[model samples]
Target: MKIVRPFSFVLAIALFTPAIRAQDGVKKDDKANTAISYYKDVRPILQQHCQGCHQPAKAQGGYVMTDYPNLFKKTEKEVIGVVAGKPADSELVKQITAHDGKKPAMPRGKDPLTDRDVTIIKQWIEQGAKDDTPASAKLPTVDANHPPVYTQSPVINAIAYSRDGTLLAVAGYHEVLLHKADGTALVARLIGMSERIQSLAFSLDGQWLAVTGGNPGRFGEVQIWNVEKRTLKMSIPITFDTVYGASWSPDSKLIAFGCADNSLRAISAETGKQVLFQGGHGDWVLDTVFSVKGTHLVSVSRDRSMKLTEIATERLEDNITSITPGALKGGLQAVDRHPTKDELLIGGADGTPKLYQMFRTKDRKIGDDFNNIRNYGTMPGRIFAVKFNADGSRVVAGTSYDGKGEVRVYETTTGKLVSTAKGVNGPIYAVAHHPKESVVASAGFEGIVHLNDAVTGALVRDFVPVPVKGAKK
Candidate 1:
């Protein structure tokens, strides 16, 4: 079955075959391009045919085909340019074959960007492009400085890279029993939590692991374990209710959580002290997060509001009365902050993930129109989980579309949907990006983790040993 993309978009695979390419990472002289190295000759081809609009500053119709990363980063629409290395499986080539200049052609206007130009883009991206930036004038590209994140596991749910991205804390049931990013090997299993773990986070100093959303005896639960001691430290009861979210502050001085309680509460990280708790929402509190500065925290609730609180003073700073366009009757499902920028991105039970100004103060009411200032827009599904990529330039969201789900990648500044991994049979329960590599681990209704190529959305690994629900030991 052929999925069609425009002339520039082709889901090409970029793989190096051992049969032809040398096993030592170098390809044999006769080996073909992996869609990446095909760049040197293809840049001019794109510049001449498609660069009039799809250049750096302006990508037409939200699509840019100038470079490999930007091309993949800008648009992952079905049948688009270079789907990795699969040439015969590319959509661009197919579109070129369609010469009617009908609704389905490239460059879409006066002159069709010729068939040869389309072929070169398909071949170059698959072969990989060369770095053309002048070291003196151009800033370093993310790829040149930071590599892809967690490459193993394929599907990542809750990932907290040790302060340095050198170590990772990943949670899953089956064999995600535990592995390190470096591969030195250590038992990932630490006992006492429920067999069904949901989210994972590490303390600021990397001394503890806070695992939330699993069984809490019958009081439901939230427990903190000391990593070095390997013993349970303190247990915070979730008021005999279901748990929704959990997080630790940047200073390691506080631990905050949200829930059926309708409001978010902060407690002392060391004493498990009730730092402060408020109740106002008539419904559940779905997600909560602490800003990187440690000065504030934000929460999304079933009350149809996004609330930001100043932790130190225990005061409400800004309240996003309703996250949806019309205050839609749904809850906010997930929330996350940027790595360095003063911005907070939120996802809702309805299908839009809105951004927020992290610097907004309590006295200045952001009001309902806050979305206008923060770049609010629609999402492909009910955003369930959200996390920033290593640099915070992009965001990863787990979404639900028509009861089925996938993870979507978007630019933080423009609120544009750049990539999506769809067609999963059920709602995606969670989505998380790797701290260091282009690896993503997502798990939903079926329980098995679906690891996908974070950049291309291709299936990289299936962590399901057995039909998660259909088979039993």
Candidate 2:
């Protein structure tokens, strides 16, 4: 076998071996060169960690990362956030990466980005940082001028009357409809980017409106609107899901709200900066209210507990509800503080409304709901909304059962059934009492705002809050 090899065969073997080795090297290079997309791989990282502070309304440090072009712009300190093809020279990379065993600087007060996320962002910048966002992924412009067009009325989840009793804010799709309290005319439309508005509140001074909502699985937002100017003052994006139960402090200096992440948070009204964070709830916090003095925050949760937290120290002070198992049959959904006292009116899955004193008047004992003041008669279904009248004389609760809805008014001290609003057609999610008049506005799945006489329970008038396309007014 060794004696009969041809010269051409030997030459061919040598050439083919080197060629195959070179081809293998090329395949490895191709795998390393795989593109990293800004939209698919990098944008989500920013949305989760950075956009909460760097969005348009809360552009901390003058860096806005919500849009692609804003990434390459100069910062307030004249530093470039991202430099194409040079991750080491990029300010964004420097801020997110650690040096001398210290944590990253950006995403201040939060945990640093995961190693994998950091690598993806660096890789995207190294690949020239191209924007690969598709047309469908782009957010539509929604604001005061370019308002949301509703083909049909959206399910109203919240409504509130201004402190002056002149304006009614109704939750709508991507907006809050401001109507005259009489329900005769639409006054203004406060449009924003959130798809669902969960809760609404007017500042005690009647100068500002606070709203909580978000895109269902994407983000949570807190919007502060200037009531008189009809302008969006600030938009603060927070958790991953919609937030609920926004309430303003008595001084209007801070706003507190419940989050889907089982946490309660408060922010500065002027700066949109998070000032207080409490994580005592075992389930999603459904509603929140400040104590009369604004020193304590009372939050009701789906965990069947109402926990109080001290705002100054950010510590859980007490569990106002009994913690004994089976004491609270279901989760709590709505909460409202008394107009003049420290009493709380709460309702939820149990369909019963119970008032609890905000502070403990006695020592705690096992299995004792010591703060329970009085129990109002139960409604026909799960209560989604509750409120006390101007003078704290009466309370209103809205409920939904099967396909029908009911709104009930009750005397606060005597616990007597005052009246039940008539002509409600669908599930009721929101109810609000007028500040100076004996009227209550109720709305829900049917999308019609009903003005009912608080004393008589008769429907005074009803109207769809949003303008329906091609439909007569």
Candidate 3:
């Protein structure tokens, strides 16, 4: 059994009450998708943080969450604990985060947990409710001598993990490489178009890679690769006058790019066909992404606006919400997803990066409301990229602040500061987390990949082998 926080007991007690769950998080403007996970991932985090007062013996506030079968025993509806895979449908998470200011997420006011823990809980609930099985919550950790192996890339920009967590995709310095997560053996290096690879993204099925960036002497192109055969699938010719971004559609059939042409273009992943080509931004399209709900698309442009379009028609939703000029516009640098939520994040154009909460509603409406139950934000450095940890509760933001090109973590809902990691002198260009652990491998302008301790915010290895107390070596 793990040590439980005290205040969380009070929260559980309050949360068990049928009435309290009903009044939990969700504002009129909140536009977040509901993802419910029950057993494997969800129950463990909840039991560890919330079971103190919610057990059958205590039955805090008349609520007993001892087991899934019994959770709805006395509850008015399945909405009491969670609806599995939908945060909006589950009142448990909302109550902990205190969506309506009724209660501040579990363990109350102080964040006794990290962002990773939050996301894992959310994902578990969203994935159809797994049991609090030891296997789901526990993992085989890497010992000092037995730690996983890997190779680093030059100017690495992005990374992706296979759904099974067996392989990882790395992009940087003109190539996209696939490697076994445990061995780091090079699987494939995307041939052709060798430039300082600026951005890389993997298709939903982990079948393809999308590469985008500009070089001083060469043109920029978005290349899609076949991971199994290690072959280039399609390349969208492009050039970023300054900066650019690349992403694959939810279905992984279309590739999109934010290019120097001030255009957002989507190309067929298979035939390399042009699916959609729309251009109208006053300046460059800084970043873009498909809404998780799969109903719309979004982009932030240097011209000072965040645009939302219905995905089915590639047309702006008739009443799309307006979030004029993100915090970083002309200097807009990067954008990242909420690992498990229907939210997207934006980075800055200058030295200081501010995180914004962008959420989409069930009806296809989007908004930037910090008070939203499903929407959350963070304050990071001159951010270039922000990606959700496997769970989506915690997000790592890549920074560009000189000497401060660090990766920072923050709680998604309360905006609570988590940790800051440092190692590079150049701008922090990209960051990605291991699918299961708190380890973060980052690449920067200085051309070095760093393996970092996500929880302690420490560099995984010592600079000169000086032994720190309790050092893993």
Candidate 4:
């Protein structure tokens, strides 16, 4: 039987159809409005592409993206790196999006961000750029009670012996391990900082030890410790991830170091005041040394330049490599000045350690020009550490490449190879000579601190500072 539908039934069908369409629209809106989290969605992009150049320590172009607070704050140049809820108005967004030929995209020489990454960053800013990172997602918290656990091998970066030749200090994971000069006993563990220790120097009086280092890409600091009391005397946090090649003034009144930010800085030993600052290098400042008279400071950098700064006036006295023209062809990594003369030694990626005369003029008015003496080609790897013997008769260097390390000594007057030691099994970052003996100490990727007889090139002492954690003593 054919029956016609009721008017109320037909009207109800139409009403429910519109209601279902409205509910579907609500679901679509909810998916579009899913909140974008900074830690979850944005941080990975930044850490992968941005943190290398834009972080708290090396905030390139005055922008830092490592932390939420620094990212949202305006820089000293009055340009805000990121603006909450306004991605288009932010400097970071502009730089990232300026991939056109008119303006350079950031990461400078690296590849630009992917389209997906850019969209996520924009959405994060649109969502107010909140700091949704959990406490555990932050950098490893460091404190006195809970020392930072260095999971990797203690890749030693520096080693020094007291002026009296009694105590030897070797760089540790987060402290300085002071051992007897003979390496038979442990004297003290100098603990104060929470990062890798890169360089260490004992004052002329041997009463204080100056340490330079920090967490790479996080912070940089100089810590002075009283050797007698084993107490921290002073702490100076720098404007980079870490520092290298710390040198002491002749009078032991100040300490100078080359920072990762390409700046040279010095601080007073008596007071923590910054006594000198000379921003001269275009790349990472790898090494620095004070003149024998303490009147001038010399520094070498990965920029392939060496600079001299007057201590009194804090002025760039000269750029040595500029005059010599191609004297240094690669990144200069290590520098050492003569103890009592106006000569210096430098080594780097060129795989050759060369000597230079600081001043050659009779009246000494003409300065800052390199007078290259000789190139010692005894080592074929990157020289990470260089030093002159106490009498300035010989120079020793530590080098490493392709997982191999070596220590070489050469006569200063001639480039004759005097002695060589090999089979370190890893890269060696530091080497030091005894003030009164022919002893040499080298340490690096290998955990063992290797001491050698500089004259014979024989391994004398192999001091293992950190044994395998779970292994038996």
Can you write out model 4's per-residue Cα lDDT over 4-29, one digit (the tens) per residue? Answer: 12344346434443223445655744
Candidate 2 error regions (>4 Å): 1-34, 45-122, 125-140
Ranking by TM-score: 2, 4, 1, 3
Candidate 2 residue pairs in backbone clash: none
Q: Per-residue lDDT of 360-394 in model 2, one digit per residue for the tens?
A: 98999999999999999988889999999999999
lDDT of 4 at 299: 93
lDDT sort, best first = 2, 4, 1, 3
Cα lDDT of candidate 1 equals 0.57
User: What's the lDDT for candidate 4?
Assistant: 0.77
State which candidate, 2 or 4, has the greater lDDT: 2
- lDDT by residue (tens digit), candidate 3, 39-101: 433554555455434543234555656456645444444346666567666666665554564
The candidate that wins on lDDT is 2
Model 4 Cα RMSD, Å? 17.4
Poorest lDDT segment (10 consecutive residues) of candidate 3: 461-470
TM-score of each: 0.58, 0.81, 0.57, 0.69
Regions of model 4 farther than 4 Å from truth? 1-152, 322-327, 360-370
lDDT of 1 by residue, 23-95 (tens): 3665654434433333334543454345434533335555655455664442446445545555555555454
Give the Cα error of residue 285 in candidate 4, in Å. Answer: 0.9
| Candidate 2, residue 224: lDDT | 93
Candidate 3: regions farther than 4 A off: 1-154, 180-185, 214-218, 239-243, 317-330, 350-381, 422-425, 461-473
